[model samples]
Target: MTEETGRTVKPGRSDSRPHEDLKLQLPSERRIHTQQPMSVTAMSRRLPQLVRRAFALAWRVDRTSTVLLLLLQALSGGLGAVALIATTATIGLVATGRIADHFGQALPSLTVLGLATGLRALAGVAITGLSERLAPRIGREGELTLLEAATSAELAAYDTPGYNDKWDAADRGADVSKELIGDAQNLISSAVSLLAAASVLTVLHPLLLPFLVAASVPSGLAAVRSARVHYLGMLATLEDRRLLGLLRWFLVDKTTADQVRSDTVADFLIGRYRQAGARIDRTTDEAAWRSARITLTGALAGGLASLTVWAVLVWLLTSGRMGIAAAGTAVIGLRAAATGLQGIVGFGARLYRLGLYLDDWAEFVELAGGHRIDRGTVRPEGPEQVEVRDVSYTYPGADRPALDGVSLRLARGEIVALIGENGSGKTTLMKCLAALNLPHGGEVLWDGVPTRALDARAAWRRTAVVPQEFARWPLTARDNIQLGQSLRGGDEAVLRAAALCGADEVIGGLRSGLDTLLAREWWGGVELSSGQWQRIAVARALHREAGLLVLDEPTSDLDARVEHRIFHSLRAPARDRAIILVTHNLINAAVADRIVVMREGRIVQTGSYTQLTAEPGLFRELWLLQRDRGRLPVQRTTTDG
Candidate 1:
């Protein structure tokens, strides 16, 4: 069924459009909807577990600092209680009519108060120092853990939207590890203070304790409500935020600057940016208004509760049930109790909100770790014959398969060329052969054993690929080539590889030769032309010196002379290693021992270039088209015999 976004909806109704805000909600929305505005009882039940988890994580980061921070916060709260008691004692002593006699008694209370204040200040400093020491370590540990998971995950996981969403959410939550520690500490501090205040109120009178609790409830509820609104709003707008970020990058990034100007797309992109911004603003404003309403209502209710508490205190005083000194202490206790209660409630709400993101991080970590690609125990030295047996593979969410019933065999010391139109399954077949991707149906075999049954890492170690879209690494020319064989250091082999690909000529022309950095943004660094970069990429692939080499459109950016030279160089290496070359240029394919032509995810013809061109087929038609366009030159070959 088609949705309002003009996308054909799947079984789960996943929306493909980036701009369709209401078309789909984040997966988290389902959980939120099931439990909207979580109750205080639920929060109370979960708080202990969350606090323990946070402490354990913090402890893992720095046990000494975590213990010290907790001790300091507890001490600070204890001092606050001591200071309150001392204040009450001083107030009682000052109530005495004989100032000279009572001065000595008041002096001890005053001294105790000063000591408590000083100790509390020291605790604050100690707590701050410990927190600063621990937070960064915790954040670093959390980020590293997530990064490890991301890098180690199965390559196919990256193709799914579910994985991407979870990854994005986890990336945002990485900092929450530090935040959770901070929140846990705040929760502990606030709870301790609240207990101290409650004890003071209880000492004043048992009735005052209930009155204080009643007065704090509404504000706590308000905090919970506000936190829920904010978090849910963020969940709803996550995709929009991502889109806005991408648009901003397109508008400002140096890599896209030329394209933006050449295509005159700045105004169109800006309009989209403004639209996304406006949508975000509307969502935030709606949340703010909802929160404001809840807050105002809570304030009104809390004010009434406070007035009732005061009225009760006044009645007690007027009826001679409470002494003036006790009444004054109770009034002071009430104010302190209210402040402590608010602190506890506010921190609790914040901790609960942050805990949700932490859960996402935890879930993503488990998912990444659990779904690892099975690198089997069997390890092979090298394959003499790599065979694809009825392989078929489809991308995630794709209706049609990228490769279907494709079978081929690659032998050592032979050059095989793959040629096809775009989306013709050539690259997919090559990826399967390289062990970068495993087929959904059937199997690829190394020698006589299936590749999946052999160790994937070991199998991949024997292969090297220069993809169509090769990475332009921001490093020195030497380092860029050396990265292909990182386990081995740069030496004569790297230089030889560079020379063989004609990249040495490009490097020789540079100011510092091989030492010259490829990034233009860095000091004393220079950029290379597209063709020059392509040569570097070719050099990098050649540096691997693997048993099998796959080159995909490797000469697309090179001049005719350089292209011919690279192809000629490959022929010498073909004596020992298997070579798979994919290209559109018919002349390049003509050099290969075998040429395979694919159409619509299946190989249609497999023969020598001359044999395929002699008959009327896709290859002949393509050759004739190239000849007519003056892209192909006539050359005599021994295949005519």
Candidate 2:
């Protein structure tokens, strides 16, 4: 068990305690698939396709930059070849002792060499500038595309474990776009350099080509093996990494700052963070050792290959098959070739490794794109009548349903209260009514037509919801309320809504009133209490001017006086709008025109508060419980009204 926010958490139910799961061993059944790393052959086979896809994406982002980058790389390669030829000529000319005769040839060779060097340097500079300009655009485009897919997907998509795993993978993958672009640049440069070296070496001697290949083989194999090991290790610890990140946030963020210190769980949290860090350290160490062993073996093989190549070059010179000047040129060519080969091999390995993440990004985008919510073309005005017809919804991978075969109707100009215990489907039902979640087995009809037939965005515009977990936007109080009615500009309406929810008082007390920033982390910003934030959320919802207003525990944090004022103000809106209020506070529900009592996943009773109090049901039992606890006023009983 763990202690958090002065509450005890039981085993297997650590949701209440932030980062508690980081300290516990996850069950085997809960683990995601632990697959083996791809072999070198598999990675090689897929590299070309992945490279093509990545290049296509980059090209689409900025054509001019892509073309310029390729041109620069190609020009640099041409300069490298010219420099090698000039070096060979200079070496051959210098071999002759007579300065007067050789001066003509050597001077021109030196001039050509200088020109090649200068051009290559200029190209390199241009490449760097272009890469810097292009990388951010590529990253932004990729991230925005991924965001579009994520935001357009149905709400139910987030409930599945598979979707969540893919989403995380995609988020990480989005970062790879910038890295992949840089890798592609390296890859092009290296490929061009390798080709230039190979061409120059072949001109010197055909036998030198094999030596260059031999030199690159061992290191290339080593890099591939290392990449696989590292990638697999990271994949194995992905969940741990996520937990570690969360633990770090909990330790540092303002949201958990008070609870962590007040509850005195800082030491416990830090211990868990260290443990997670240690696990990652162990995994990394093991992978590094494995890679080191493979690299050591490859180094030995490469050394032997290099020795054989040098021996053959010596034999060629000693046997008079090659002149001293030619031998010198051969040596220079060999060194350049080896360097070029190493660059190509190293870049190839990096690209292949990064390709896996890029593939994940691609797959996630495709999957999410396919599952986009098709908000139909039919625009919906404020719905006068909404009906839930035998609706049922079960979360992904869960055996039990969150909402069973339940049906209800809501009409404009009436206040309907839904009261139930925790996990009694109150929240789920409210989400369905708001058109956020589609029922699995039935339909939600707006104006006697299925909601699926209406434009989702348009339908959502007609509804306002104060969710149980309302977002505390870190903007000015005025901006927060304005966000609800973004299509309109009504400073008067904003103030009126704030007044209705008693949020006007909260704003007036602020250092800058409506203009004050809500985030404490920012300059001249201040954080409000939970109750104050709830009032702001209420004002935001009320400002929407939505015909259907769904409030799920909207007053859960308000004091008695504030709660009374808010509930009383809700009555004025109820005259033209349909209000569905879900709360545990029975006193608030008492004023509702009609109360619907729910138990488990089903609505067990429906009647006015007075009618429910006189009956023997869950509603009566709950009211008596609150009354005995002195939470409900004794004077406001069924006997009075």
Superposed Cα deviation of residue 366, candidate 2 (Å) = 2.4
Q: Let me know the TM-score candidate 1 reaches against the reference structure.
A: 0.89
Q: Point out where model 2 deviates above 4 Å.
A: 1-40, 369-377, 397-399, 484-489, 629-641
What lDDT does candidate 1 reach at residue 239? 76
Instruction: Give candidates' CA RMSD values in order.
Output: 5.8, 6.0
lDDT of 1 at 251: 90
Tens-digit per-residue lDDT, 1-641, candidate 1: 55565565556544663443422346655466436657688678778888998888888988888888887888888998898888788878888667687999899998998999899888988877777777788888889989987876777776765677777778877877887777778788878877887887788778888887989899889988888888888886787888887888989887799999999999999998888889999999999999999999989999999999999999888999887777877787778778778877888888888877777788778767345676676777667788999999999878899999999999999999998889999998898888888889989988878877888778877888899999888898988888745645456777788888899899889999888899997665899999999999999888875778899999999999999899989977787788999999998898899999999899899999889999888888888887795555567699967
Candidates in order have lDDT scores of 0.83, 0.83
TM-scores for all predictions: 0.89, 0.89
Error of 1 at 131 (Å): 2.2
RMSD of 1: 5.8
Best by lDDT, which number? 1
